[model samples]
Target: MSSILSGTPIVYFECRQCKCVLQNPTPDVLDEWKKEHQGHTVTETRKYPLFDLGYNDLKKAGELAQIANELGAVIADIRFMPHTRNPEFSLKHLQEVLGDKYIHVGELGNANYKGTGGIQLANTEAGMRILHGLLANSAVIIICACWKRSECHRVYVAKEYEKRYNVDSTPITRTSARDLLSSVEEKNNPQLALW
Candidate 1:
């Protein structure tokens, strides 16, 4: 993993209060990030798609995991009760495929799905502990489908991490599995090629 993102005093903050994600991530920078982390392990977090209703299905998550795996990224599904809305797959299925890389970091377990209520969950002690434990000292990439940077939950997660660790979590704004894979595909061949 490249230390450039972690080595700097400047941390990236994605403010979710206003509903956003990591400000604009330059194409060159994203390409550089991909190049810099050639062999380093990456984690692709699978959450219910923010705007896309199709990705709420667990199968899409598995598809994304396959792409991430091909690109050397481990699948980390942070949803605890992923079956509440998506029952096509079970937790066992995710664990079976993701293996040791699967983690259930349900930061929003107690919060409402409407993004209201418990807005301060990240500021609570338990929330801080969970966020810190999952993010501290580790480089994280937040993925979501919001075109508006300030409206991405991945950005929200990053902001929470920054609030606690005072460090930046890279945010990648892609709306679908294909788009996510394509973003990397634009930078590197075969690695992101899933067609």
Candidate 2:
């Protein structure tokens, strides 16, 4: 039997006859490999992207857009009350800034956001279904106002998505997002750094 393992930092290709290794194989590459290999089975090990971002981390909607663009993901605002003191993080502003890439999944949000009540599954199943539909096309980055994942309802939502979808989720921190953004900027504007 032959198989192609993907959806991780690295992708691996193994066959009963021989082993071929490729790093970060794109969709085109995977397609070409399949055509050439013929009869080989393909198994994707890569989990869908389930990111948790706090507005406190990246204050600007443009910054959030950059991160989402880089990940090729839709921004899922998982806050029951999407309004925030910061105008940039407000629901209206986010919808404007993100345009088509933004969505408010209030169903996944915690109804008792102010109190001690935990995740309400009543609407969660519906919300998860919505997210499931989205995941079929692109990755999703769940966002909230809380600075820490442990201190936010997004943690529970992330867990639910992982369990329901049978895929691992990555948490995007401020530092990590900044680093990726920096790399992207450098790639785009190499001449700017020369000065």
Candidate 3:
């Protein structure tokens, strides 16, 4: 054998990718690293996480609202058009989930299906002030909407915060209520999947 064997070695006895003739890590070394990693763990915990309640269907609102409550989030309902005629727009379930923290702020007009008007409204100076106030009190602000995160005006609002406040304002998007619920459940039940 040469003094230096540098290449992707095919043998299991040798390191696979390193450009050296080093032997493969022994099982003892691997176990020691695993034990060290397990003992010295570092986890980041966020005080508050913004939740966007993006459910247009009233049938599922109650379920999503419960999940949001379990996750400890505030709900925001954005209605551009007057919801006087729409009983579903009352969002009673969401209000119950958020309690006094529920806030509804938007212009009175026809629903901006294209969402351009909503984006503009959220990007205005007044809009920035309201968002700033929300951020001041809470570490995260949850935007409850009837659409996905990328398509919702809440994303625009987050970006506006990033621009005006010069802060990291990336909002987490929950496309599926089931997904969020499952994730929260997993966090609570650590033994469910542990070997």
lDDT of each: 0.42, 0.76, 0.47
Is 1 or 2 the stronger prediction by TM-score? 2
TM-score of 1: 0.46
Q: List clashing residue pairs in candidate 3.
A: 51-142, 52-143, 53-144, 53-145, 54-145
| Per-residue accuracy of model 2 over 4-104 as CA lDDT, tens digit each | 11112334554433356444577898778777777865454333556778878886899899888877888989899888789999999999999999999
What stretches of model 1 exceed 4 Å from their correct place?
Answer: 1-59, 67-80, 84-90, 108-110, 114-124, 136-153, 175-195
* lDDT string, candidate 3, 1-195, tens digits: 122111121122222233223234468865554455553432322223333444552345455555545545445555554243434446564465556666665521124545555444533566556655654444334444445666666666566567665555434434345555555566679775463
Q: List model 1 lDDT by residue over 32-98, tens digit each.
A: 6546555555332222111111233224556645454433433333333455444433467656666
Span of 10 residues, lowest total lDDT, candidate 2: 1-10
Residue 194, candidate 1: Cα error in Å is 14
